[model samples]
Target: MKRLVLVALVALALGGCATTAPYGNFVQPPVTVDQQQLAGDAAKQLAALWPPAKTRFELQQPTPDEFGAALVGNLRSSGYAVLEYAPQKASGAGNATPEQKDADPVVVVTPTTVALPLRYVLDHDAGTGLYRLTLLVGSQSITRPYLEQNRVLIPAGYWVRKE
Candidate 1:
């Protein structure tokens, strides 16, 4: 009986040594996503346009950087080169001309507090089509078309997917 108890203790110790899954591994990362605000027809469409991880995209958080870290972490996991852009305040030009010539798109995350938890402002002017994003309860992200889009009708601005 003592030998059996020892074996059980060893098994328990081994199990404890196992590493726990990262926060992002879980569907809902201990965060809250309000659904009522996210509800509507356009949310699904935005989700579809949201850039996937692994791609090289520039990031500009104009808002209070609500999900900046969390988002970058997620994107990095997917093998994306998430570059942050902080244009020189002294320069009159908002974006450098040379950078604009590149094919890589710039991602803008602007939080619309008036509509947060329901929707976030995503600007990728370099990208092309209609884009939309809505955050639902249980941290669920529902998007239509079931894929990301490269060509959007609206290139830059804080507008939801109307079409």
Candidate 2:
């Protein structure tokens, strides 16, 4: 009975560690600037790591604001096909008319090629008056720091890319 109980306890502990989610969801903070220039710079750096035309990006986070918009635009301009995911609102608490359902039919695209999932983190340090933008693509990540002055952001240092 003692050995059986120990095995049960071990199984329970291992069960708690299992998770289905591929990655943790992080809240993206707002930025003061539109970040067009910064996004362009980041896009250029990312293009060096991954060829823009060859690689397709599926952005894992919603970009409802300026910085996200800028990043998406920049990535597109850099020849990347970026797909941003946004959750669809339930129609009237799941009671939708047939007409409504017909109007918005769910279209799923199964590409022959795999698109890399991309995530980004934009954080501001109040004490240092600096902004850090980190882009994570597949298993790699690149981070760059920026300093804001008079509504313009200047690069504080070189990008640090990590595999």
Candidate 3:
């Protein structure tokens, strides 16, 4: 009886350790291009622009916190203002309370590819990691000519790079 109980306990413990959402650990499946195309397109659009002379960016994906932190660092280096991130928090049963009602304008980031590619090693072990991500730098003030000239907010395929 004692041995049987111990075995059952061990089995239960091991089963509990298994998980499905394997992030930050094992190498995930290969990320397809379709998953990350939008962000790539947005980045290409921003890269083509030469104005806003003093523009700012706000990232909204790959875990909003991580994106925001990186954007803040990048913008700071580029001499652009780094605005505060206002994460939407659950308010009640039906809606989310505004973390900051006067949140700054932001550009959203979306992970086109959620899985990582596999690599072959001497041991032939598989690994998981994140591949490229597609970001959309959208803003409500989509009027300025500089923004227009760069075709920043233009629909996809307007200036898609063929690489």
Candidate 4:
């Protein structure tokens, strides 16, 4: 009985080390308004935190949805060299750019390039009729709330940054 109990405890301890994916499915509901404005707002806030010309990002989520595409465009327009690829596949691939369909093949790392991993989450609160956008970069994050009225989304509050 003592040996059996010890074995069970060891198995449970090993199981505790397992981890799931860090990211969840991006929630983008259909809206009548263009998402570029919202995405541009987010990009502007991000650029304020980390200068786009000095920073490079590897986007962890590669969803081809409207918000994702718009965010990428906004980031690029802000002068950020964003990398869109699967994190798992990029492992052990060195600095070589991975081949992706319909994506620009250019992910070069330089000495001055501040490469940081980035992810975003957009969620809508049905009860309050507000949308929240969260952008995570490395160990830092910024969140902003937006309200949709007259078929347009506008910032509802000041952006909050967390380190």
Candidate 5:
């Protein structure tokens, strides 16, 4: 009986871990198949405007976050190497000269949200007393980001994709 109970406990523990989503920063950005596919197209379009070199990008966060990741992933999937650029911090070596590392130019990718309606449904099985998520759609636009003049406008879905 003791051994059987231990085995059941171990199984339960493992199952709990298995249910967790995989994401390091913030919640897994709520992204759909269509969202990724459309974002991929946007990345390709942006790539064409720049010279044929590895394009580094400064993603406007929550531009939305998931959409940004999708954009970067799609850009990579499209055979282009991408890097995130952060402005170099001032080296406080007071007279210590730092090596000048040449870097490829980076473009700031910003997202602009549009209005759209997303309905969410929640269902509770009375017998189980557990609430289940039936829908994740958000009230925001599903339009992909676009470049106007010089700015890259991301869609509202990225913003409202979560909350």
Candidate 6:
């Protein structure tokens, strides 16, 4: 009887050792938003005729510094006022040159990604995931036909300010 009880205790100990903390507790490393979306013809058409607007801007990305350069380039080409936060000493030059000129609104873009649970395991643990993010400023002001068509539209409430 005592031997049987000892064996049972050993089994319990082994089972306890086999248990592990869930994977959800780990912090996910930040990811970049590589996909680019344009406001399309309406914006391009408007920008072409109208002079670029003067404004202050800042772009924040959860990814690396190079992501900022890409965003700046895209925004400039689309005709938005893009500056490095100082409106007074703004450089009218973008990745493009003077003859072609770029777009306006002095846009600041911040791109980031957040992990979303795919499904809960046993109704309490996240098994897989996805990322959803959006532009906090001027997102509503402009229409993104490509984003809508692709179904990558960031919902209204998911806006997170880029730091």
Residue by residue across 1-163, what tens digits does model 3's lDDT show? Answer: 9999999999998888574322221213342223122333433344455222355554332323332344344445544443444457775534534754446646678644232121110010223222222233442211111111131322322442221
> Model 3: clashing residue pairs?
26-128, 27-127, 27-128, 28-128, 35-112, 36-112, 39-134, 39-135
TM-score to native of every candidate shown: 0.27, 0.68, 0.27, 0.70, 0.31, 0.27
Give per-residue CA lDDT, model 2, range 1-163, as digits (tens): 9999999999998887684333321224544565777778889998998998899998887776566788899999889989887666665836877788678667788887788988877777778988888888987889999898887888999999888
Greater lDDT among 1 and 4 belongs to 4
The all-Cα superposition gives candidate 1 an RMSD in Å to the true structure of: 18.7
Could you give candidate 5's per-residue lDDT for residues 116-145 as a string of tens digits? Answer: 212222222346433222112232212222
TM-score of candidate 6 to 2 decimals: 0.27
Number of clashing pairs per prediction, in order: 15, 0, 8, 0, 4, 8
lDDT of candidates 1 onward, in order: 0.38, 0.79, 0.34, 0.79, 0.40, 0.36
Error of 3 at 83 (Å): 1.7
Put down candidate 1 lDDT per residue, 57-119, tens digits, no spaces.
454332233344455445455444545545456843466587565657667886332221222
Off by over 4 Å in 3: 1-53, 61-68, 88-130, 139-163
Please estimate how well model 4 matches the true structure, expressed as its whole-model Cα lDDT: 0.79
Better of 3 and 4 by TM-score: 4
Q: In candidate 5, which residue pairs get closer than 3 Å at backbone N, Cα or C atoms, i.e. clash?
A: 62-65, 111-154, 112-154, 118-138
What are the per-model C-alpha RMSD values against the true structure? 18.7, 7.4, 18.2, 8.7, 16.8, 18.4
Best by TM-score: 4
Give the Å error, residue 134, model 3: 1.5
* Model 4 lDDT per residue over 1-163, tens place: 9999999999998887574334522445556666778888988888888887888988887757788888888999899998885756445436445554445756886656657988888877779988888888897888898898998898899999888
* Model 6 pairs in collision: 79-103, 79-104, 80-103, 80-104, 81-104, 81-105, 81-106, 81-107
